[model samples]
Target: MAVTDKSVLYQHGTLSLLVPGLFEGTMTIGELLQHGNSGIGTVQDFNGEMVILDGHAYQVVETGEVHELTAEQSVPFATVHFDDPKVTTHETKLTKADVEQKLLTDYPYKNVFYAVKIRGIFSHMLTRVVQKQEKPYPNLTESTKTQPKFKQENVEGTLIGYYAPELFQGVAVAGYHVHFLSNDHSIGGHVLDYTLAEGDVSIQPFASLQQHFPLEDPAFLKEDFNYAGMSTSINKAEK
Candidate 1:
């Protein structure tokens, strides 16, 4: 993979689109990697959780089974950037809340974006992967209602994701959005909660964001998005 600017975030599709059930994939995994190596997203039709780490992509299905994705695989939404952390902090025994708080307190930037990576042993990890949706797909909130959640204890893995400001809520997740992948590639999914046994938290702040839309998709072009309920649905689905 070619090196990309660590200071820039590349995103495909808007979070708002998923609010009204526009789950069709617009970009292939190969095209996504051309922009970055570490990030998070969902596969086409919200089939599974996606984690891009060390220049490779992995899909964690509803059953908590991990599979490395082929280049031809696609996604409807994703955020990626070459991860080159300028700050690395060693944290121990930190809960999910503590980690989020620390990241907020340490950086204290409300408008900019941050790429985050945490690698270590986790005492407890709670994650969920939404099931694949067929045609007449339900909105994100409804589709996630039957999501399969997984709980793992004392596992070593890495967390990959980004932090978007509240001002860009409909464009991306307003807060930390991360996914987990185990070292052995046996289990992983969208991170709901976790307790870090000990780990290194690395972060890279970015001031630039490049948003790309699926202009070729007719559904994306014609759908009347529910801007008013986007935040509400996003919050519900994310939490």
Candidate 2:
């Protein structure tokens, strides 16, 4: 029952700093690809969203457009892995919460990382996209407060994200953090909530993780990250 027996999750940067408004990136999309084929993350300056699926990289900007990313593009934070998941198909409908519960009920393993990919038609998909921030960017909670939200129906897409254990809480979000990409590649964003009509849920559990940080970046080096009430901030930001 060891998940990710064959793959390692290659992560760049730290989620804690990004949450607190460190939009500067230490790694390029090209460099990130050297590690894994699939994952999710944000672009430099918090300009837009990022999705890596099937060894390809994509960017979803504030303009509601999806662009194929170039190697030179910078990434502030991302999680990627060579995905060969253990999957299960479901014909029944399920809410976001229900999906989480089902994952726990079946897998039931703690203290590991899981790459969650759900593909199907969604009855309702509620998503949010953060705008690019200027210098002195606001923290994640404040930045997301004014984000634009989209509501779509009968949308076919894949939900991409990761589930981390409590031990990595401050370093990574402890629970599910997923993003969405439509099959047509026209509609996608950070998933706030959704209901799946029917689809397949592919779960890849990674027993090991590798973190890469940008030690040379001045911003990453100088920022005095304040974690006070970070739990509350993360909870508010996730929704």
Candidate 3:
């Protein structure tokens, strides 16, 4: 049988999951979701493929295949800055498969680039069963949200600067990918790095990232820019 025809199964209580013909490991929901700030194992597709990174989400229509965490989907991402001046570099726990690496910088320096593996499940029946019985996903409304320190979007921020390589032509910097998590309501843009460049990169705050290199339109860090529910803009509801 095609993968789509099979059910997308979620864990009994947590967001972790299992899929058709892909169940061999003995990872618990807690063990699977113990990840970086991106909520790696928390992401599951209808097909049972757990997300191993923080990226876009997608779904294959021909066979009703839903993509968990992926590049094709535009999921919310973040590039958080540490408060302490000395704490420039930071890391968020992602999926288990993610391998952390430190790239060399221009002046011959090294910095850590967080490697995240997003989560996604493929069994429709799993998540359905989990949802029907437990319904334990925390009330997101009570959660604290991270946002850009500055209000307006600027073109000088590192996030935007990333798009314009010339902006950071010769600087000691380390860059990596991040996720923009959203709240119950849609607001604030979460900035993440896709690492178009490879070297000792600089990480910036939400405001600074936006100022350094701003996107035309930005989503709040809390919103899920990837693997989102069907969009309402085009009336393309999931059948």
Best candidate according to TM-score = 1
Give the alpha carbon lDDT tens digit for every residue of 143-231 in model 2.
Answer: 77787877789999889999999888767788888999998877888998899998988888886888778788888888888778887
Write the candidate numbers in order of decreasing lDDT: 1, 2, 3
Native-to-model Cα distance after best TM-score fit, residue 28 in candidate 3, in Å: 4.8
TM-score of 1: 0.97
For model 3, residues 1-239, the per-residue Cα lDDT tens digits are 11211111111121111111111222333332221212222222222212222222221221223334333222111121221111233333322112123322322212222222211211111011011011222222111121122122111112211111222211111233222222111211222223221112232212122111112223221234322321221111000
Model 2 clash pairs? none
Candidate 3 lands at a TM-score of 0.21
Worst 10 residues of 3 by lDDT: 124-133
Error of 1 at 126 (Å): 0.4
1-239, model 1: which lDDT tens digit per residue?
34477778999998888888888989999999999988998889889999999779999988888989899999999998988897999989999899888888988666789988999999999998889999999888889888888988999999988888989999999988999999987669989999999999998899799899999999999998878878889989986
Query: In model 1, what lDDT does residue 103 have?
Result: 88
My TM-score estimates for the predictions, one after another, are 0.97, 0.93, 0.21
Please give the lDDT score for candidate 1. 0.89
Error of 3 at 150 (Å): 20
Model 2: how far is 46 from its true place, Å? 0.3
lDDT of every model, 2 decimals: 0.89, 0.83, 0.21
Residue 135 error, candidate 3, Å:
22
